[model samples]
Target: MQVRNRQRLTLPGCSSSGGSSGGSSGGSSSSDNTLAAVGMTKNQFRCVFNPSTNRDVLGRANTAAMIDKHWTQFTSAASQLNFRFGNLDEAAVFFGMVRHEYGGYLDDMRENCARQGVACRQYDTCRQGGNNYYGRGPLQISHCYNYEAMSQYVGVNLRSNPNALLDANNNLGWRASIAFWTRPEFNCQGTWEAVRAFPTCPAAARAGNIAAVSQRINGKVECNQNPRPANQDNRVSWIQNVRTSCFGLPRLTSNLYC
Candidate 1:
């Protein structure tokens, strides 16, 4: 799943300049101005990831145009599915997951697939020749079954052509990620429905429950550890950073770890 050293295609409006510093740390009155119908704005995104400071997996500096394009595709895909964030907190949580999942890289892939286990024989033919159905896209969708299921949801043959998720010409990556996010089915440990339930949960249940959300995403590896692992802590930190630093909201004081 790791990308070999290759010349990356120069995307429109992106420059080869180094990244900028991280965003300023402070609350903003406009933090709650986000609308589920429109998703995150370019300005808000910049607040989370300053292009000059944040670099993609490929070492390219994020740009305003790049952020805008991603937002457009993200909202378009969400609209197609008629999915909307329940509130700004939900949207912030989603971005927090995204930041931890792919580091805001559209073409990002898992660094390795050696430990991903063997592919399912039933869908063996679905692997695109030499390609492995390792993690790809925003949520790092992995495995042959997942690719097959996502293919059905997206109406695209992702199982047969897993590279489609990395297709920069279209929004397939975002679509797949959004589809996975909203799916009610189980992945590894819990159902994505649990993550989606965050917005409607009681105040106490919702308080710093990013660990509950992580349980659905990667619970087997990161959750239930007496002493939380660094990766799990990092995931929760992203949510906290986005909630407080980027969105100017109070930090969740409880259940911060899985």
Candidate 2:
């Protein structure tokens, strides 16, 4: 059986959110300014994130106010980790990954833990707790180890309450996703490093590489495969679409595949 780690990308209609254009600003002090710097307006964000068919994910609507609230929290979390969105390219890649992973649904779940085989060993505590920690949140952060780590990083007891990652009221899902994006853990730091260094780093690693970011997110299952996994292609395509359609970029940077 194929182990589905990420959801298939389905591009939605999106329009550019005009704003400033430049490299990273080291870090932004204001979430509103950061959003503008990254060229993400309420409509663009909603176009890419809000599901067209559903009233909302679970019971929470991805409303403009909710999106603003989440974006604020996301910026705060990135700042806490000494990271920043920097530019439109970085924002495209980040949101692209989120689109591929969660498909804009907050209640999306990845069940069937036993199929993970040896990977399930590290999350024994979550299994014993009678809660399957397969995947949750915007990035679909899986495993008990990740939950414990994120709990420590966010000062939340996710180990005891993994469901909190899906709670829109507390805005833990977006916070956990941003924390995962900033920290280096999943064997690929390109996602974090690319965005983090956009301001000062050289051109080679400056704009961010979607391929490297995808590798970091799920290289074990999708990268370096014989058939060029459809999910991988979908990820790249979705990100590129976000770049051109959402942010009005001509094309992606470099290294677009893993």
Candidate 3:
């Protein structure tokens, strides 16, 4: 199975500015200290600054720590990925994907990989020796070619050091997610193009064309498996949860499920 970077959202204020409200979320230690000191929830302080994760998934405690540890890397990656959206509709759908993919935690990411049999192997014959490109980072990028591509894009030489994706401080993993989002693949256009297209493209997302978006990232409906575990269904459910929790959109009425 080919593992691609799927459904990574750029958090509000994490990406570059597209509108007045959506400024860069990268702040200094003092800001983080202040947020933590004030006893604010992750939703209030806005955790995972770039491509905000679901507050329920990350919670206040983990969100605060992630902000303090990986905010800089997340911001850098968000800028490159163009996480900032022109409207709330675009944000809802895009971030929905992010929440579905990462849930703002490493353990959740690992579990997803395990379910799909991705990045769990010891070695791969498809590429050079010792290239264990098991799922790492927010997007769970796999395969050696992907590692090489990400290495070139992020200037990290991931092909040589495949384990670099596991580093939270350096955040090679999140960067790989962003890199994957911007590039085109799976026969559908890139998310960058869709987000940048403004009203028209965002309208599609807002209208609940999630099936189309899934194809853009996943190549096909991997979520709708038959007779057993439903990957696509789970993804759709996460997107719905994210829309409700992160964006405060209508929980039941919104056309979130694909």
Candidate 4:
């Protein structure tokens, strides 16, 4: 499943910095990189600057290539959303969701729509010369209620034409994700909040189950207040689970939980 990297506990020149670490992993390419696997269900491997050659570790071989092709879009969208959120926990959660939503392919969603007969029908009398049926955009913001909101927000007349899902330039790729970040329909219906900074999240910083702690943090802020999935994705790893990830403490300068 996940092809992991060779483990070496000793980090390079890692001094007792307050929160940052100095360890490095060796990899010729990004695809060949190793991820911190089998622990935090959330992909928690430290990012390496080299090109990736490690495919299995990231659940796909061409991940680096794909990200490279699309990272600009991702980063740009993330930049806007982060400004709104003002929190790193939120940022990481968005990262995970983006990876999950379209396999990072803003265009791949077209395939999903094609499968659902979105491009194949005719209509008369309903509105917009009939409508398509595929799920729309990165957030799967299906149905009229959701789409209408997005259309209004975007100032587009999607109510009439309805073929806007495939456009890569518009905000649907990223904006829609943020719009639905914690809607009741998603896996946790919880907007992924950034992990509290060290000291702010000491228990979580030291613990193994990072996901649970992150959950606790968002839960405190009502980001995760909706109904959860039946068999949920494990929120975090053992170390991440050990600490409380709540962002409500004082000195917390985060953008979320406001």
Candidate 5:
């Protein structure tokens, strides 16, 4: 195991699912910022709250039971990843997102969060999808309307019962998987192959290459259609930023030392 000088844990391609992850901020004072199970002491905002190390917390032995219970509509690994991304964040963000999005207050809250999130260029904001609004699911899908639109494709009332997103099978950790394989940008040809590039420029180029792949799928040039220039703050760039934040690594091809 190679220990990074900065104690950075870079996650590329391969996926691991434990109970959850823990994060804490350094030199700051906030009750929510405390680190719990990660076995490391660091000051940084955590995406997942204090993770449970108890063997039962992850409950892998009962995953099939989890599915059979209908806790989640997803039967495939891809669908499960899609359910995890957004929910994988901190509890506050998770509560704020799911509570407003798919909970009792869904219809309006989804719009509210999306409007605030997307326009503000923040996650959980109202997003613009082709015909429906996707909002912040996995890959931060902007327009949730796509959920309802795509429901028929998956044969689930994905848009109904907002609280459904909170279900363990759904919320436990499926969102990330969905985004990895399905997003238009993610599906672009040779896209997955370039994810391991070390620095930003090449990383952005790889992202661009994927966007080009997307163009073929989209057939029309659009703003989120290509990768943004180096250091440029745009959709694809921001998406990479999120990935970087999660994995504790830089997406830049230059390996720009932070």
Candidate 6:
């Protein structure tokens, strides 16, 4: 019900594509300048794009060229947020936490759209209001109702411009994601308490607490079973890689989830 002017969607914590891929004034170096233009620091840029990992979430080898080629688009989208992450920890934890899942979701949605002719029938929400709402954006937003709500929140009129979510240049992809994250109603628990302040300064940033945070984002505990959920495992791995390899942070030793 509440739309427009929501705390500027400020995030004290929480926290990117190849080439111009689309919407860029220059090449890789130009892409780097864009981040600075948007007020993102060099360290913040590295945490988001150059994770210093061997392989990305899709299992492709991670390389500087790959970063040069793809991260520009991702950074473009993520930079739409008006707020800045407080530190490297906040930025790395958030970027790592979401990169795999959202990146995977975008791929899946594109495949579904290709096969289903612009609409995915598997999700009932996609059929609402006769809008053929397929999952789009980093968070893979589906459901016509949700689309309309997001349009209002982002001031993009997504109900009519739903495909804009797929347009990295428009920055709608990340906009929809941040909107969903800050809103408590989007989660099954009616609040994303996991992202709030905890006994520690960065409670959710700790790897042990990743499962709890994932559960909040996923609305369920995914990695607790004998065979961990593929999505859950991917996200956990992403966090681990970013923390150790990219940020050079200590390993999260707690086994919060088996």
Considering every candidate listed, which one attains the maximal TM-score? 1
lDDT of 6 by residue, 32-149 (tens): 4343543343433343443332222343333444444344554554466454445445455565655544433222223234334443454344444545565565556666767777
Instruction: Assess candidate 3 and give its TM-score to the true structure.
Output: 0.61
RMSD of each: 8.1, 7.5, 8.5, 12.3, 14.3, 9.5
Per-prediction TM-score, please? 0.72, 0.70, 0.61, 0.42, 0.32, 0.60
Candidate 2 wrongly placed segments (more than 4 Å): 1-8, 17-44, 50-65, 79-82, 107-129, 185-206
Q: Candidate 4 — which residues are off by over 4 angstroms?
A: 1-66, 78-84, 110-129, 169-171, 182-231, 234-258
Q: State the lDDT of candidate 4 residue by residue for 159-232, as single tens digits.
A: 55445655655554455555455333322333334432222232332322234434433334323444542112
Number of residue pairs clashing in candidate 2, backbone atoms closer than 3 angstroms, sequence gap of 3 or more or interchain: 0
Candidate 2 displacement at residue 221 in angstroms: 0.2
Q: Compared with the true structure, what per-residue lDDT tens digits does model 2 show for residues 168-212?
A: 555577777777765555333444553343222212223667765
Candidate 2 lDDT for residue 199: 26
Estimate the overall C-alpha local distance difference test score of candidate 3: 0.50
lDDT of each: 0.57, 0.57, 0.50, 0.33, 0.28, 0.47
Q: What is the lDDT of residue 189 in candidate 2?
A: 41
Please give me the total number of clashing residue pairs in predicted model 4: 37
Q: Per-residue lDDT tens digits of candidate 1, residues 15-133?
A: 11111112523232443244437444444555555564455545665555565566677778888877776555666677676667664444343332322233422224454465566
lDDT of 5: 0.28
> Which residue pairs come into collision in candidate 6?
16-71, 17-70, 17-71, 18-69, 18-70, 19-69, 19-70
